[model samples]
Target: MKRGVSAVFLDRDGTINVDYGYVYEKEKLQFIDGAVQGLKLLQAAGYKLIIVTNQSGIARGFFSIEQMEEFHKNMLDKLAEEGVVISRIYYCPHLNGCECRKPQLKLFYQAQKEFDLDFAKSYVIGDKLRDLALCEKEPVKGYLINAEKKIIAKDKNIIICNNLLSAAKDIVGFKNHESY
Candidate 1:
């Protein structure tokens, strides 16, 4: 039997880079503070990093798929330069009501099957409540990034953090050590 791998499912727009509304240009790519370091820590801790994003801009005609791909390529290249290796990216280029969009489980199930993921040991991290939808359906823990600390979660499986790095730190049990 193949062992299930643990993974960290991440959101791209507001969670990773600054959300400049319908961002599709490489020139506008900006990593949120501690995002790179957070990913590095997760990767180092043996979590397979995967990005699950909803690129509604494609559906809204704000950007083409090619442009989004180029932006993703540039972002991936930059992350690579920083020694962060993303295992894969699963995106739903659709508007609200798409089965594959965030808060939906289509993409999540696909990743689970492809990776033989261990839900008990995995996590989902993003800046929106929809990003933590996996927690409602699966045993995977969720980290909701709310820098303002405004959103309140009633689910015990969900943890709200100020940013991705804080979530990463909590995931790897480095909540107290802050020298990274």
Candidate 2:
């Protein structure tokens, strides 16, 4: 565990890739506009990119985790083609009310323990409020990529942005911890 390893945690659906409701196929994967660029920018700025996603489809039997992993590998290959390195990916397969699920601190804390993350200086970027919930327990800052355009957030620890690109810009620009 390193003390100064800053990270930018991201949501998988809608933030990095387009969310089309239980998308689990390689052919169905679509990178959101500026996603590659944004990731690259964050990487260049010395931030490790990590993904913490909630994929309840597994709990619902809509898809197996092995299927998800295959498709996820495909997604990672595409990102690697563009030189975007995702440091780690952690997901919850539970339908709800699980320790590793979002709005819960388990996955983030686990990642923290494994990666030696500096929660105080880290950041979270996602499309939904739960994606930013880790901020409720820790001082980590957050940015919401409001791709859905339907959520009305009032949390002071979170900043709302139009998309991943804008969020990345804010993140890299506010490296000194200016909460957007």
Candidate 3:
């Protein structure tokens, strides 16, 4: 890994694409407004794009792991067609309380180990407080998306944005500011 290699850990549903609960079909996937552009911006800024999602639906029997993999394949193909490449995707197929669930650091740990990431320069962007809470260590900034600002007021360290585009801009801005 390059020295100072940073990663942007993203939550798949709601943050990347529209959260159709337990989504496992490529035909059903929908990208939120500005999501592609936002992700592209992050990519241009040299952040490794890693997806960390909790797919409890697999454990709930709503969708098989193969179905999820197919869905991800379709999603990645679509992104590739758009010139966006996701570095990796890590998902937790276990039910609640699983070590890899959001708010837990299991997936983060795995990513760090696999990628040799500089957690101090990384960030985690998601639609839930749990996503932000997952990165309590150094260089792991948290960004929350909730236009209504309902679940994030308690955390002063969290940056809240109305959409993915705005969140990307905020993260880029923060990174630039820190470099000065």
- lDDT scores of the candidates, listed in order: 0.92, 0.86, 0.83
lDDT of 2: 0.86
Over 55-133, each residue of candidate 2 has an lDDT whose tens digit, in order, gives: 9999999999999998889989999999889988899999877898888879998888888889888999998888999
Count of clashing residue pairs in every prediction: 0, 0, 1
Winner on lDDT (1 vs 3): 1
Ranking by TM-score: 1, 2, 3
Worst 10 residues of 3 by lDDT: 171-180
Tell how far residue 15 is off in model 1, in angstroms. Answer: 0.9
Clashing pairs in 2: none
lDDT of 1 by residue, 1-180 (tens): 778999999999889899989889999899999999999999999999999999999999999999999998999999999999998989999998779998898998999999899989999999888988999998989998964566788899998888999999999998555577
The local distance difference test score of model 1 is 0.92
Structural similarity to truth (TM-score) of each candidate: 0.96, 0.91, 0.90
- Tens digit of per-residue lDDT, candidate 3, span 1-180: 368678888999999999979989889989988888888888988999999998989999999999999999999999899888999999999888777887788888888889888888888888887777655655577888854645544555678777777788887774542232
Best by TM-score: 1
- Candidate 2: C-alpha RMSD to true structure equals 3.8
